[model samples]
Target: MTYFKVLFFTLCFLAFTTHAKEQPLKLDKHLSVFQPYLGSWQADFDVAPGTKPVQDVGLWERALNGKAIRTKHSINEGEYGGESMIFYDSKKDSLVFYYFTTAGFYTKGTIKVLSPTQFVAYEEVTGSKEGITKVKSTSDLKDGKLVVSTSYLKKGEWTKPESRIYTRSNQAVKFK
Candidate 1:
């Protein structure tokens, strides 16, 4: 009787273990346009006319079994941070994303892929007290660097565009 019980337990364990293994995740073909940006990066941007440049660290990775892309970025080592998730919207037939920031604002956007290494994003900001309601950005990856230029619509007026250049880095993103 004891031997039979031990054998039964062993069989159950093996069956559970075999079923627990998961298949490898494969990135959706629609996300191939973001391949160049799927890694850690660092950039420095001038926040003001004479102030020193602030460093921003970012990480991008495949998420949700490769059905979506996730990005997290921090500025000045945690002064501000945001996380974004990009996914394909089958009904809309486009790539859509949402960004949640530590600054108490969030954005919903759509992406337009131009080439293998270039894309444009249009965002609508919500819950911002600064009256920034719209944002448009273009990202281009070339020669081991990522360049992003952005413009903001605040108080119903368009602001001057600013650009940032990012390179591959080993830094990690942090939030305070």
Candidate 2:
């Protein structure tokens, strides 16, 4: 009986180790969808609906051995800048992002990939001048241009979306 028990435990341990070895920690294949956005871009931010667009630049780079993508963006010539870390969460089966801004604000959001070239990110906002609580941002890439529309939730209703269009930068954008 003792010998049989020892054999059974050894087999179980070996089986567990083998299974663990087969599964390495890595990003999901769906991460390839972000490949097209892996460069530098320049865009303008609409201060309000149909208002003048403030110049901004965005840089996206692969980081952490391809496990995540990091974004650094400068708005209005460094009036405000932010960094975002985007990664796939295997446990949640979704893409997650954490954003920190120079204005002492932070947002956590999840990206729902609508397709390879389109995605929607819903964010919970805090520490803004208007006290915005929630925001929904939709992004689509077309003809080598990236367009993003963001809507804020106010009084249980989604407000008009502010849109921004970004074009690929042939030259690097420098921020102050």
Q: Output the number of the TM-score-best candidate.
A: 1
Model 2 scores a C-alpha lDDT of 0.84
User: Model 1 over residues 47-126: C-alpha lDDT tens digits?
Assistant: 87888679999999999878899999999889999999999999999999999999999999999998888999999999
Cα RMSD, model 2: 13.4
| Candidate 2 residue 67 C-alpha distance from true site, Å | 0.4
Against the reference, the lDDT scores of all candidates come to: 0.93, 0.84
lDDT at 161, model 2: 90
Best by lDDT: 1
Off by over 4 Å in 2: 1-28, 45-53, 154-157, 170-176
Q: Which 10-residue window of candidate 1 scores lowest in summed lDDT?
A: 18-27
